[model samples]
Target: MVQLSNNSALIFDGLALESYVSGKRSFMRTPSVSLLLPSPEGTRRAFLIMRNVTAINPLCLPAKAWQQNVAAAVRPAQLPGVQSHSGCHNQTGTCVDDSNAPVWQRCWKQVCQNIDVACSGARLNSAGNPAPTYYDINLLDVALFCPVVLDQACLDSLGPLGCTLLYESGAGPGMLPAAPLAVALGDATGSQGGGHGSATPLVVGVIVGGVVLLVVAVGVVVLLVRRRRPQAQTAKTGGAPFHEGLDSLGTRSTTSAAGTVGLSMLPTESTARAFPTMGSAGSGATGSGHAAPSTWPLPDANKRAHSQGSDTTVITNQTPIGDCEFDVKIEMPPQDGVAGACVGGSAQPDVQLTGIVLGRGAFGRVYQGIYNGQAVAVKLLTELTVDSADQACEAMMQELEVLGRCNHPNVVKVLAASSLDAARPALVLELMETSLDKVLYAKPGHLLSLQLVLHIALETAKGLAYLHPTVLHRDLKPANVLLRDPGSDKPVVKLSDFGLSRIRHSVLKTMHPEAGTPAYMAPECFDLTAGGLTHRTDCYSFGVLLWEMLAGAQPWYGMTAVQIAYEVTLLSRRLPLRPKNTPGGQVLERWPHRLSALLSGCFERDPQRRPAAADIVKALALAQQDLDNLSRRATPTRTAVE
Candidate 1:
């Protein structure tokens, strides 16, 4: 694992090895990383090199490699603008095409052509300019090459002379040194100049070179005699000596932390198989530890285990459903109050998750996921759920069944869904930033304004109105309602969580195995003896929802489920019509009394007396108009000069 200064890293997990002197192929590809390096002087200053004993695999590394610190430099082969020709210095007067190119060209072109070789960088300097990032797939131990996976495709591109690179011989074979005066000699001789006309200049250079060499030799002898000490021995790492950070040598580190990547590399002659989302299967042959990416947010019960590097919510103590046994079919929703006939409809496919949990609920947990390049929220069953794993699957499937048939603005749109996981079925939905409950309780005493409250109420009612004819949202509450742009004045409301919702085909809908939050459950829900729940059951919940929005608190705050059930069912009581003892509570009082009166109707103990979703929408609309008209008259407008 070589971590680039700019967070770009080149990692090798698993591969076989070959010796450097006889190495022909390179397994590691430079384009796999994105690196940006500063070029203050500009013009191709440095490029990357991956010289290693083995294919960057931890399993292949010996114990000594990890024992002590070894420093290796990621130095470039050529000097700045030296213009050195190819290494193929043919004694026979035969010309080859690639023989005339620069020193690093073979390593550069050999890197995959499909990949964009030039880096579109992100790291910048004081002037806000990005550094130049270059890659040369020449990461072979110059002195000790390793056997790689690729047979011949990854071989060095340059011909026979290409085997010897600049790192071994400074100016490349048959080329003049890049030193100060030596550079002028090469330039005068020219790339193809073989005429005797350059004899006089060559003769003058030899005399000057001899004199300069004598003076430098004498100076070195005096310094060595005075010091009388031997040169310090480095750890003698495989590559050049290097350090950390963005310096003259660049960000590439030669040696890094060791880890294994299981390539399923077989001793038999065969190619390895890997996917985009490959799990880390290190070679246990070396006892190297590894872990899978923990993108999934686990439940509260599993939080402690997760903190200690354990896996996220895994289904246990439950039966798993393999091939989904449930059959799915849906009807096209009614348009213009005319219901469409039943038709063959298919359920959505299962989605892959990154294991990141976003939110959790009674029955299901939500995880952040991506589908077809779009971010989505995938709902899966929690470790500890509403009832059993079976019920959780039932609820997820039920929600999918309902959402598949409906397409309304206020309703949450389902992108994909599948209950094949059985114990942990998935429901992928369009990602919403926040939920109404999250925003409402973001801070204590953070009350919603009259306009904002009505906006939510109106949208929620419209969604209910759309669903009432065919289905009923049995569990309606703040958490179930999603908000798109919560920061804006008019945030869009999307009614979600249809697990408790059921198709209203029967006049008396019997909610068997009765399950719902007792605080929001209608009074009729408590008594199974009374006529089973109706569309108006949602009306009771809507009434509580309004009170919650107005007061910025729970309807029966600090009360247990049993206490709430006793108070609502046995006592037949509803929340106060006005938001009492709350900040911005007076905003509701200032509004027209019609909204309050509508709330009273929604809370009617008798299901028949409660307003239907359609009627509630009409009443909220009227109340909105009255409030707006009152605002116009109350405002003191600029008087015209008479």
Candidate 2:
């Protein structure tokens, strides 16, 4: 992982070996990621690479080769002003003939085209200077035969490379060193020079070549010394000598070329055929290691031995709804003269909150209160709710059904809900200081305290685990999670908001309606028949929220909610937010990607492929635990503190 600046970061996971040396096809098309810029500077541009391998999945060979193709395609353009010649015409009046040109030429054409599009009607800041635009060029480990240049042609056009912009050489053949220099284009607007005659262009080329040579020289020396080191022995044995990050070398083995692998060796059936059934199948596989199909309600009580084995690795066997039965009823409460207004005595003043307004919504306002002398949050449904009584009642019912039986420390407890009155069906909830969105984005710093973020993720997962049985908190964005304090060393996150939540019983499981905040909705939600929405939907939302929390803002950018949703579903639109000056960006530049991959398992268009909420909890818990261990090891022990 690598941190570019205070605002951006990056994480890289392993790509197949062929992406570096072979011309293979890539598996990930339009790889979307969330990115952040420290200051809205002029066009932030970056290059990302993924490399490293511990084991070889022969089936993934094609994907590896494709990754290399993408990397190779993007590298040559790094030469700054060394534009690739192609039949490309941009607003700059530059023409590129990409048909007969090399990959670099094509890359250059694309970059130029992007610049033209980005700068269109771009506004200037108060200082009358164009705000910095941002661009991220992804080169997924295509092996480079020569060093690439970063010069004025590229830098001046794009401004500072925001967040993490790296050149990685791993897998395939190792990357050759490149001289990173700045090219001085004297008055770039000047008239074109004579064909191959201008001294200015020639001098710039000479400078670039000189820098390349220097880098190569140093690289050669480094390689030679590395070859002689004891670590070389391990490297030759297909073992990595360095850790994976922007600076580390990631390598995988592949003796057979990509195409040589027989298709027969791969599964001939469609991915759908290989998929397991939804809820029932999930419970069967999880409750017992034997892997059978489960019935409705997840019958694990009689299968002790199997449950124990599966419980260690699989989570479907554990259902939060096991012992409790939900009491369902339909009754309309009375409403005062005010539309949706419901009044009640202040009997719980001891536990009612005072003057502070904890939250607000389109319907009404929520205030802090005290209940039993403890802090509480009271939400007063407004007259508007009474006006739309039917829809409001249904929404409230859904919330109660889902949240009433939920049990998790991270989830806000619904002490009580009064739907007796259409005008005042107020809800009582445990009080917390603020929402995750407020802590991470509303305030000035805009950065989540690292430890606090980790804790929040953990606690939220715990709550999710409990919701997996009969309900799934479909809306799991930062705004739905409450924070305990502004100054607490460790922030406590409590999951809230169950209006869009759903309850999925084994016997009553059905698809969920497409509804949620655009930025947080999972791809699977688009399909109304997606029965797996029970737990997997939450996972997808979690991924988006995680990215936003790390980036300190919204996960996707668009002018409106509709645009954001469309981009997310079709294009997987994402911005790169890693910082350019920090190692965090280098090491974790692709962390968001890993999260996306996991979310895919949960957010599968098909529910069967989606892992249960319990699985999600386990995976996230493990990740958090790993981080904790790493932190403990990194921190020096102080006698007084200890």
Candidate 3:
């Protein structure tokens, strides 16, 4: 216990502050404590303790249990063994301890404000359940240790507190002590999501900080670092906290708290949500065209992902892509060999194969692998789809030629290609987490909002526009559109699987009549006799995708592929638009008339009359603008909080 004078303070044995002093900023893994402001009864407070405190996996917690735990975490309680702060002047009413130090009080107030917003958002789901969430601890860490670790500017960001904590008292830069820091740099030791094998999985829990900070110590910026005896860890299940920084301070450690921290939390595969994580934000997609992923301030899913409020029907798969309402997609046959060089001059050797197959197809398989230090998708050709080795080699060459030329952020990229004579002919490609179809059908609470729909549409259209006038993605259905959320709730869409695409083709009768998915194909696809295939063929498919997204269901929920071809091509029928929402998951009140009109243009009977991909991109951009205006009008401007 410390003094309760004009600047009353609580003290810990001094935890992780030592590591920051030792220059292990990147490895500061510690349990984070965030105070939730209680109802304004003169500085009452409660805090949520994170970093593997609960025994059961938070993902598996029942709705009731989850709520109880959260209630417990946020319940107001006095600091243990400490009385009211007579010196505490909490005019703002966010402080918990009595500290006259401006920096100390100011830091807690700012933290309380942010926690106020996040706790409200993360506390409940649409069904009013307590959804598990990972609140960022970095924000708090920066405030408390700014002077001790961060530069002058970093310390300055916290306003007057900066000078008061660092220079004003001449106590010098200081902070509370923490657990020993530790670091283990290596690849994730292969634990696929949702695996329930008997083998004990050494799951690396997200290490916000592998520490328990208890006190709001006051004095000099830092009390001289006291080496507290190692605290025993509470029981944990399935996974253990990953320790960050080097374990230079202690010999006592948990079985698994021996590795990295300061990383993003891994989602349990049981939830079926594979959004982009700061760590391994999807294997491919790491080319120069894409920006490095960053950590985002994620709010509650219910705040952004609203219920679809669309048709809830069961769709049974007929063929690969169901159309008798068969909505399942079937793989298209590979084309004959291309004459150009598949490997050109920059041929890459076999990828560092993890042997983890991501997907399998008729001509080959996609593997989760690493290439030159980056996670990548390795698409390899095999003899299963072809009669001979030569045929397999030719198929790989053809697929590579089509994708190798594409270099755009919105298109799946080809990083490297193998030679036709290599031991394993493969294509090293950027990997995204899930297909657009998955995003559209994401759990009711994580479905698409209009802003996201338009975003996916604009990005997809841009990819198409880049390919047009030269290539035709004969199949442009939702299944071909890949998505990666990259920390932001909005998923980034990129076109993939150009297996059915044709490049630099002529009106000369094509070789494969059944080249595209029947549901997404243009009428001319049914009868090349009707008209020649062009980029317009892809527009029709894109329009169908837009309908699927709005409807939040398959385009032809109950129709067969043969029937779809007949109805769409001959009768000129289209599925109705599904309902859509805004960023906050509320019904987009501005409703997209422009989007309806664009769909009409795309579905024009005459290919010549259909809007081009570039035209579609422009129209989608307008819808985005409409969303911005609607948001501004709906939300009242307020002075900034804290």
Task: Give the candidate number with the greatest lDDT.
Answer: 1
lDDT of 1 at 613: 86
Give the higher-TM-score candidate: 1 or 3.
1
* Per-prediction CA RMSD (Å): 30.3, 26.1, 28.5
Q: Tens-digit lDDT track for model 2 on 297-401?
A: 222322323211122221221122222211111122223633221244333222333546777886656777655557767765554643676666556655654
The TM-score between candidate 3 and the true structure equals: 0.43
Q: How many clashes (backbone N, Cα, C below 3 Å) per candidate?
A: 18, 83, 42
> How does each model score on TM-score?
0.44, 0.43, 0.43
lDDT of 3 by residue, 350-389 (tens): 3555657777876677877666678878776653533566
Worst 10 residues of 3 by lDDT: 317-326
Error of 3 at 502 (Å): 2.6
User: Lowest summed lDDT over 10 consecutive residues: which window, candidate 2?
Assistant: 195-204
- Once fitted onto the true fold, the runs of candidate 1 whose alpha carbons sit more than 4 angstroms away are 1-355, 382-387, 419-423, 511-514, 584-591, 640-642
Span of 10 residues, lowest total lDDT, candidate 1 = 197-206
Q: 154 in model 1: Cα distance from truth in Å?
A: 56
Could you arrange the candidates by lDDT from highest to lowest?
1, 3, 2
